[model samples]
Target: MNRNYLLNDAIISPLGFTTSENLTSIRNSETALKLHRNSRYFKEGYYAGLIDLDWINSKFSRIGNPGKYTKLEKLIILAIKQVIDPSQNFSTRSSGLVLSTTKGNIDLLNNNDFSADRIYLWKMAQVIADFFELKQKPVVVSNACISGALAIKTANDFIESGRFKNAVVAGGDLVSDFVLSGFQSFQAISSKPCRPFSNDREGVSLGEAAAAIFIDQEQSAVGESVHYIDAVTANDANHISGPSRTGEGLYQSISRLFNNSGVDPSKVDYISAHGTATNFNDEMESISFNRAELNYVPVNSFKGYYGHTLGASALLETILTKKCLLNNELLASHNFTESGVSVNLNIIREHKRKELRTALKTASGFGGCNLAMLLQKQSL
Candidate 1:
């Protein structure tokens, strides 16, 4: 079925409230991350993509039960408001809600007052649906790091399946004691900003953010419009917790997206990579880029600007990638030098100039999940 599918609306995070402001930040390579000294554990002062929650609360004061919500809820609501204001969309009939996260409400466990198993993945869905009072059933996707991209995939499916007239898909996660302690356990925390695919690359900096996208088949012709050309999810069954060192899963995901979308790899102008700056992730991405023969396509990572957002990472990165496609601009990879992988691909070290008609956003998750999305500029 050649169903009607599109990514017409969005509510992004860690950059700015509006598309223009975020795009400007990307062009200037200005980062939203800052070293925080909060006593929430993990006090080595990691760079975080800080959100102005105070501004959000004051701006959307009329939202329901605002005081009862947690920081995660507040972030979700803020992004929700960007797409469907309670004053409008809430009063309507049932709408679809897809919330993605790896570890929902992990901040609650910091005080030793809460437990981990209590955080069932499905609870994330209920929390958001109740907030808007839309009478809609919410779907939650908890695929570790690939959660965000999977949320987008689910939204696209529902829209194409005629399950709802439209949908609100939000991705959110926080950098709390739980995540920081775990990353530190794995020895994945970097003292300074990360450098992806570089010989001097260290581990990733963990951060938190919430982003929402309103995808619908209806063309309003009034709002800012962009398309999610095609997306796919693939798993490396060989490894339960780690990626295929050969980049097999990543390569398969991109190959599938291209084959499904009928888009050529050589035609892809830019790659919004999941360059986490980890030794393994960068190498895998480079291997995949080489196999796909997309080395000429300039590449960059938002991790330098917005740590590894975990569940919300891919969605946030895709929003930035779409911005580049809309503007035909290429961003730098922040800290990078010396090829770690055997590939001739141009790993963009500085903001490069280019015309992007098509761009690909790729992500990999724990539990062997990998995903890719192909996007194209709309011909006006």
Candidate 2:
């Protein structure tokens, strides 16, 4: 099987528009989550990570007509554009596009200005595919919060199977009234910025972001290269909204990943967890990590910095993990002060330097779905 190498990437979020900018903000301990008093999202104010519409529109105007696209579409387009090289002649037949999102254009359900067809997930994918002139049909992944990681996994499978030479995987979600109300109804919206793994941690702080990366057999020339070893997904079928109490699904996923890849668990130097900060989710992950004997590894969650970005969480977090490996640094789990879960974990609470090489990026979502992807720094 041909090894998939992660090449160029981009991130458009509340923190910044580019991956470098977002990393700088994280290094400075800056968070995009804020207390929004907007009644449009909820009856009571809630905290979330939201990008400024004006800012994104201004940036999109330089490349394409912002009016022709939805907010999420524009974000994905801008992100994918950054990863694509204008000088390289992309083979339309061999290239693939994978889009990850839980709810694409969900906010447009009641809007009359756009046709109903525009609200379909496939339509959203088509818009992005057309923007890049990708001739092949795009694949869409929407498995709750695990969608982003699963999308990347799908692309990796395609490349490994010799189905495609390369693929562009992009994911994004919006912080809208529809999404906010859903969380609010579950009483999972935090009153303030989230504190992942902290004793005082509340619920999740929703966030919106778009992230994209190019993956192929060839290493990238412009940035630090990383090898996409393998990814595994498991479902415990525990509940509709809650994770497995014993972390069965997550543990299985991690175990399978290491077993198949022939990599020891101890080889994993860092963990970018799907730390939503919700009590059940965080606790389940803690137990899972302990079960997998990853308790001693340094781990951190980007939720405090970007909130739970739903479909974009896994992809966005994975990109940041690549950045951490390249810079040989461990970013502090923002807003984390004390350990909250039952099992002890080496949750990174302070920004520090370390010689990172291998990383395990984990994501668990509703319906007991869990995924773990292994990434290693390529010794260029």
Candidate 3:
């Protein structure tokens, strides 16, 4: 089997458009989440990190026609365009596209003139694939918020199985009336920016983001000291909208990841957890981490900075984690003051220097879906 490495990546978020810009903002502890009093989704004001459509249009117009692209489509195309180098030559026939999102063009249905045909996830995948001129048929993964991480895992499978030499995994989602109303109905929308693992945390702040990663087997295509170690997924099917009370799926996934790879949980220098700031989600993760003996590891959630970007959260967080590893710095888990969950966790409170050789990324979405991935810094 061929080895997989995260070759290149780009992120289009409210913090910034490029990866470096976003990293700089993260290092400074700056958050893009803001209170929106005039949101189109709710009558009451909500907090979220929304992308400026005008900025996206202006940036996209320079490369492609803006009049023809939807909001999500533009974001995906721009993110993908940023990571791919014009000088690098690769056979399109052996490279494919994997699009990840929970809802694709579902917001399009909110408009009266929107075509129903555009709401199909496959159609959205095709549009992105055709734009990049990928030879293989595109793959779409929409398994809740775990979609992004699953996309990366699926891409690695394709490459290792000799089905493809490279894969561009892109994940994106927008906060719209459809999504906001659903979450609001569930009382999951926080009135302010989310404070994951905080004792007085309310709920989640919806955010929008688009991120893409280029994964290939060629070590030379990627730089030194960064490669995917493992990706494991599990599901407990405990509920459609809630996590398992025992954290069964997450614990099992993490345990399997370490066991299969023969890596110890204590070896992980940092953990990017799926801390949504919701009552069940945070508590569930606390149980899972402790159950897996990862309680002593330094952990943090980016929800307070970016809010919950749905399907894009994992991919976006993974990209930022890669930056953290490269810089030997750990990002502060913003807005966390006191431990809210039942278990004790070494939550990061400040940006500190550390030698990070291995990192674990975990996410638990609706339907009890859990995913764990291991990233290792390699030596050239």
Highest lDDT: which candidate? Answer: 2
Superposed Cα deviation of residue 6, candidate 1 (Å): 5.0
RMSD of 2: 1.4
Q: Quantify all predictions' global Cα lDDT against the true fold.
A: 0.74, 0.90, 0.88
Each candidate's TM vs. the true structure?
0.89, 0.97, 0.97
Candidate 2, 1-380: lDDT as tens digits? 45688778899999999999999899989999988888565656778899998899999999998888999999999999888864152466778899999998999988966778989999999989998788889999999999999999999998788777889899999988898888988999888799998888888999999999988887756556787999999998889899999999999999999999999998999999999999999999999999999999999999999999999999999999988998899999999988999999999979999999999999999878999999998776
- TM-score ranking, best first: 2, 3, 1
Model 1 whole-model lDDT (C-alpha atoms): 0.74
Q: Report clash pairs, candidate 2.
A: none
CA lDDT, candidate 2, residue 170? 95
**Model 1, C-alpha of 176: deviation from truth (Å):** 1.0
Off by over 4 Å in 1: 1-14, 39-44, 52-66, 86-91, 110-118, 222-225
Flag regions of model 2 displaced more than 4 Å.
Answer: 40-44, 86-89, 222-224
Q: Rank the candidates by lDDT, best first.
A: 2, 3, 1
What is candidate 1's TM-score against the reference? 0.89
